[model samples]
Target chain A: MSDTSFDSQTREASFGDYFALLKPRVMSLVVFTALVGLLVAPGSVHPVEGFAAILFIALGGGASGALNMWWDADIDRIMKRTQSRPIPSGKVGAEEALALGLALSGISVIMLALASNIVAGALLAFTIFFYVVIYSMWLKRSTPQNIVIGGAAGAFPPMIGWAVATGGVSIESIMMFALVFFWTPPHFWALALFMKSDYSEAKVPMLTVTHGRKVTRQQIFGYTLLLAGLAIGTGFTSLGGPVYWAAAVVLNLLFIKGAWTILRRDEEVAEADNYAAEKSFFKLSLLYLFLHFGAILADAVLMRMGVTFGGLL
Target chain B: MTFRPDHELHKRRKGRNIGVGLVLVGFVALVFLLTVVKVERGGSLQGFDHTQRIDMVPQGSNK
Candidate 1:
């Protein structure tokens, strides 16, 4: 698609269209993980400071999303899943998206520095740069390992949140980062399996598109095993309690089983069922992160209430 | 052709410009207020104390 395709519009853009440019779904995950990171850290933050920290972190995440949309407008136009996005749909121009993204990025980073500490603001700035420059601009088109490496950009939020509270990084924050980093591969590969044609059509080198279904399934299974180990191992850290351990065990079991199911299916059966297993795994992956983070938040609250547990064996 | 001041598209664009300006102004004001609150609460804006230090001497001693 040509850039001119987005130049013609029959109506004015609505507020919702501008909001969509921020990729609210991704921003929500960033906010939740960052909140968990902040809440679970060792120190306490004042209520207003905590609120401001989260707000700035969210803005930073939204800024990255807008920048991603701006750069990926061409591939996004080709992909069925992203064709209705503001830039591609003639609701917002690419230059407008770029300006909004840059403006938000500057405001979010500077304000976060003022509201929290320099470490956190710097991390947020690096996260935005990593996502926009490294992942979106360079990696996504260049490599099938894009999501694997690109996952770090998304994984930084909780660490940023942890920094917001403690003004530094800790093992707990690193574990939180690792949790998301490991979870990202299997989570996105499942979506790739279901949307293989979209990636191929966009000429974006998703693992499924480049390596074929068998290799992709194997990779998913391999990453899931590693992710399961990390998820369960995280339960023994200071960040975890009985609640988190139990949630980890159950969620990992389900996630492993989902990966196993996908691995067992051949392309013929997968096609016949319209990739139901992959879709189901994708949905479960969403819940897997939410539940794990929820468990951590619960553990933090319990600890504050004087409830404690010995590390799970 | 005669000059026109109130074309619908022009009016809508003006409204949007004002709305965006107001939002930016509101954000600046909020940040200013937060900074004031932080200073009032004894939080250092520069991450360290900026007050001048003074030396003390014994009551009967002269330096």
Candidate 2:
């Protein structure tokens, strides 16, 4: 085993390590939501341009993830969950990650401009900047609200997808953005509840670390309620459909149940087998967002078939 | 340093793994290169213009 000490010259990077830095999982989520946004919007986009937009958005997301990995290498090294990450494991050098991130940032933004309009390109660029600069550099170390604000960066993909379709932002796109924005706090807080030691060890000011566990639980429930409201309400917008509405209702109920159960558990009960309640909620949160977007895609398909739902039905 | 019984065998297998990995990487690169060429020669994004307007509704109906 390599020495645990942080050193500049100890570990050489492999291709897999570099790939891991891109956070391919997160990038996939960005690509899917952005694709849904583009497909469901009212306006038309050229097929080539739409493909390019999604490609660029995915690359931009990857770039942000790379930069985040670069910046958080220190804290990542200390945290068990992140210790195997490229930078922390010394498989990829920080400078290389930074360079890869910067290069991809420029390429993705430029390609987006060529493929689509300037608006989509600009949004893509800003999303990268927000994740790398605002979220990683500024908020992450300074406050527990890091993920809350950084969540906006993740939220931009849908809006960019909308811009690719319409060449402008719409209320519908913003609603999708808001859905993600509100959902982020509770999702991440649940994660923090389970991974409290990870943050505490890294000296990161997660909500659970800065505040007491009870406060974090209450906040999680509060955000869950807000997320449920926004999610259902968002389905009433231009993008909403019977499929989306049904999905939202089911997902939100599950999400609320998860949050409520987490709230009711004391630390003793939660930590009985290593924060089982909190961990389960965190895992479910990932599925919740994905199912919601999947429902949106389904709704779009159903709407295309000329199916509408009436109150009685 | 402590050595497991299979350490030498594992070390020997590393070369084969590296070779296979490189070949896979090369294949993927070649595919990407062909795609870029095709994209450049052919039109954009596989020419998927689903955005073409189909006008069933009267243009000035809203007006």
Clashing residue pairs found in predicted model 1: none
Interface RMSD of each: 4.2, 8.8
Cα TM-score per model: 0.87, 0.79
- Give lDDT tens digits, candidate 1, residues B1-63: 997455444455666677778877977777777766677765323335654223333355443
Cα lDDT tens digits, model 2, A163-204, are: 988888988899888888888898888877776467777778
Deviation in angstroms for A151 in model 1? Answer: 0.9
Q: Which ranges in model 1 have alpha carbons more than 4 Å from their true place?
A: A1-12, A309-313, B1-22, B43-49, B52-63
Please provide, for model 1 over A1-313, each residue's C-alpha lDDT reduced to its tens digit, 9 standing for 90 to 100. 4434433433466556677888999989999999999999988887677888898899999989999999999998998889999999888889889998999999899988888899999999999999999999999999999999999999999999999999999888999999999999999989978875677888899887788889999999999999999888788789878889889999999999999999999899999999999999999999999999999999899889887675323
**Residue range with the least summed lDDT across 10 consecutive positions in model 1 chain A:** A1-10
Local error of candidate 2 at residue B36 (angstroms): 12
Clashes of each: 0, 2
Model 2 has an lDDT value of 0.82
Every candidate's CA RMSD: 5.5, 7.7
